[model samples]
Target: MKFADLSSATDYLASLTRHGVHPELDSISKVLSELGSPQDKFPAIQITGTNGKGSTCVILDLIYRRAGLRAGLFTSPHLLDVRERIRIDGTLVETDVFLEAMQSVCLAQEKTGVSLTFFETLTAVSFLVFSLSRIDLAVLEVGMGGRWDATSLCVPEVSVLTSLAKDHTEILGDTLELILQEKAAIGRSGKPFVGTIPPEVLPEWERQRSLRGFRPLLRGQDFDGKWEGETEAGERAFSFSGQALSGTYRSSLTAEYQLHNLLTALATVSVAPWPVSQETVRGALLHLFHSGRWEPVPGFSAFLDGAHNPEAAEHLVRQIQAVRQENGKVAFLSGFLREKDWRSMAHIFTEAGDHFFLTVPPGTNGVEPLTIASYLREQRPGIDCRTGSFKEICQSAFNWVAGEPDRLLVVTGSLYLVAGVQKWLSGDDSPLHAGERTSASPPS
Candidate 1:
């Protein structure tokens, strides 16, 4: 069935929530095959890891565009529009084009008699769009673990695993070793599998690489980066020396952890067939921006970051501590999914903020704000913790931190929560409002 418009198309895709996340690859393979295997039309760089996958994808996209290549990017958990998940030449895919691709995928699914989950359908849509657009390169972010992720259907020219941590434990695995094993499966035999692995899991990563027969380009041993002082314009400056390329670059991204992502992107691009000059890489870094990741809210002394898991929370806490040292009262407006380790995150957050405003994120499985507040109170009786709806909590947090130049409010925990706060702040009343959309459900 053809969708009459973008709204109807999005609604139809959203309705696939009933199918949930089926991690196996058979369904996606069938759907793509029906579409003439568009994913094979162009070379790709596939990225997977517990964290930094999205950032690495965006960085590679920017670098490719700067180098004058038609690049297609596919990343999950869009903050606003579903169309944001698919981009060509650094711009969101046009509505007409998106609808056409969706229609094609729907027709393919009908012919195959296979039900596709939200992520699988979108992945097929991305592949079709990229092929039709004749993109020079495709940067695909695995929606979840790499082994059976829909995006893994392509034999990427380079496979990248950005910093591994314990996340999506319910699906990926509980320990770092198990998680690495799953993510490392994206690597293809004889192709470059470039990324940084924790020292503790080096042996497990080695076993995975040996079994898969992928060429390893491990960080620190084969390549590495050193953080230089910020540029005069406040951009991050770092020097990267690797086996394929060596250069000093600057980035507009603020967080310290972003340096790791930049390194991964550079390494992947350097090894892939794509020929990006050092000058183009330098130019791309200066304009990089990933919303809802340490992004400063307009007209407010606040920032929004989607630090949902314990590892990410630790990064956010480090940033908060740095801000505090610079003389600001740090406060948090946070929410999380029920499946995440909220207790560990809560304990970690205490090192950064004294005031907490809790609210439920959009969609199902959100941890109750009152429940988080009670836990926080039990842990630190003197700490101030409040609970309410997203709007109520945001307003109260704003009021509490306003008018003080040194006071900063951080809205974080889950990307779903960050999206809701961002949409409310921007005054968008669309049905995809973060409060109403169930797009945050885990996608395998």
Candidate 2:
């Protein structure tokens, strides 16, 4: 069946949410095989991590394009449009192009007689688009764990693990060591595996690298970087020293914690076969962009971030604290998926803000706002906590910060929530509801 429009195509994908996450590659493999194995047409650099993988993938894609290479990038959980998940030459694929690719994937699935999940279909579509576009390389971010993620089918020239933390524990594992093994498995036998890991997981990472027989380029050992002071134009300045390359760079992305992601991207490109000059790297950094990560709403004293888990929440809190240092009172408008360690995140957030507005994201797995509000009130007796529908909470948060110039509202917790807020901010009157449980699966 061919889709006549983008809406029809996306509806078809949304319906696949019923299949949930199978976490295996057999079905995607069959679909790709029937479609002429498009993933093999271009070399790839596959990245997997609990956080920062999307940022790293985008950074690498920008650098490749700046160096005169056509790079295709595939990331997950689009903030606004599903087309955002697939980009070629640093531009979102046109609607017509996405629909065409979806048609091909649909036909292939029918011919192969293999059912695919929402993410699996998108993966196949990305590969098909890149192959048809004749991209010089592809930078793929794993949707979840590495071993069974459809993106793992590619034999990457270099594999990257950005950072490890407790997330998707229900599927990956319940401990840090188990999580590391699942993510680190993205490394190909002879390829370079480059990334940074917490000190606690270093030993386990080493064991995984030895077992997989992939070259290890650990951060602070094989390569390292330091953050310099911010530039006058509000860009972040950093210096990188790696095994294959070294340079001082500046990024338009000003989040302090993004320094680690920048360093990871540099390390990945340094060892990859593609050649990128220092000048190109510097040029690319001057215009880098990633949405919904500490994104400031225009003409408003608010920011949106998708920090769902405790580790990411910790990074976000550090940024919030910096704002507080300037006599700013921070307030959070937050929502989280039920599967996440929301209690730990709530604990961290309490240290960042005194006022909270809680709401459920537009999906089945989102934690109820009343439940989160009750927990917060119990944890912090005098804290100002309120619960309501997502839209009501957003209006209340905006009104709370309306007249106080020093009060900053932060919309965060889940990317799904951030997307809803962004659409609301853009004056889209359509009901802000995600169609189904199609993205990441919640724990059983």
Candidate 3:
């Protein structure tokens, strides 16, 4: 099979684990062992958290690339292409190359009777591609909690946690302590577990580190970054202590909370024990780009942060505090699966000043537009918001933008929603055709 024949890697992996007896690490580890442990050759930075994992991975890729090294980045649930899951130096992999890698992974698994989950197969395929491509460093984001995620197979040079929060309660445990335990699973015997978590999580984190025998780089304790000021270019100025970088300029992604994620990225970059420089951090931060996180299209602004759960909704609201505009109606194009906290998610972002554009991506997890509109009215009465096909919503938003020219528009609430809008806006077919209602399924 060739790269062009590699369109449905997820489908192929899904077939293997369709009736998953379990999602365990040991089975995945043993299978990788049979395949020659391609992950062992992939030296990388590992990041896990309820949010900000994708942003951190992007920053790591940018920084390492700036350091004159070939960087491979593997993230989840790509917006446009499966190639987005496998990138070198911030660019998507070529079609033929990616297909070859997937073919190789399929061939490797034939000999290892133990089946790998969708995420596990994707992770393994990424490692195989990165290793064979001669990547100098790979940045791998945990697909879920660190402990059992397929990416956990390697011992990363820097293990980073970015603001622990509640998510994936069914697969992980129901509480924060249990959630942190699952997330902290990536920490190896001696690798430094660097984090930019809030001070409130310190006590529980320290206790866990002691038990795991992992070295800790707690933010504000081991290393920290200071917000210098806002630059004339409208970008932010900040400096790091652990990495010893000064006057670093950052063009942020998603939320201003991303500033904290950026700080952790720098901390990991600084303490990486490899020959990386402050200049590299600056260069990387300057060019660092990740789509679907508050990305803006021409004529209309489209913010694409996935606010599936309550905590993410709160964070998105907090990040929006920095958004300044004199006047223009605020409207949101948002929707989610029936299982999520839809009422709370919408309330946090639907303030006194904003209008709403209800949308459901064409996916299994997608909440119907009218259903969302019904919920929105139940949450807050008499607020006029459009509910319809995603393309119709974008045209509505774009038309609104043409009139106001300065109004703020946000398209969020679900990854499926983002993928659909991204595909439509870019003039390509929306990937919603691939949507599987995972959020509505019974607990694993």
lDDT of 1 at 379: 86
Name every residue pair that clashes in candidate 2: none
Decreasing TM-score order of the candidates? 1, 2, 3
lDDT of 2 by residue, 269-325 (tens): 889999888888888877776777777666667888889898899999998776554
Runs in model 2 lying further than 4 Å from the true structure: 363-365, 429-444
Looking at model 3, the pairs that clash are: 3-99, 330-355
Task: Tell how far residue 335 is off in model 1, in angstroms.
Answer: 0.8
**163-216 per-residue lDDT for model 1 (tens digits):** 898888888888999889889999899999998889999999889988999999
Candidate 1 Cα errors over 4 Å, as ranges: 325-327, 429-444
Consecutive 10-residue window with the lowest summed lDDT within model 2: 435-444
Two-way lDDT contest, 2 vs 3, winner: 2
Off by over 4 Å in 3: 1-4, 8-21, 198-200, 226-234, 246-248, 252-255, 429-444
Error of 1 at 434 (Å): 18
Pairs of colliding residues, candidate 1: none
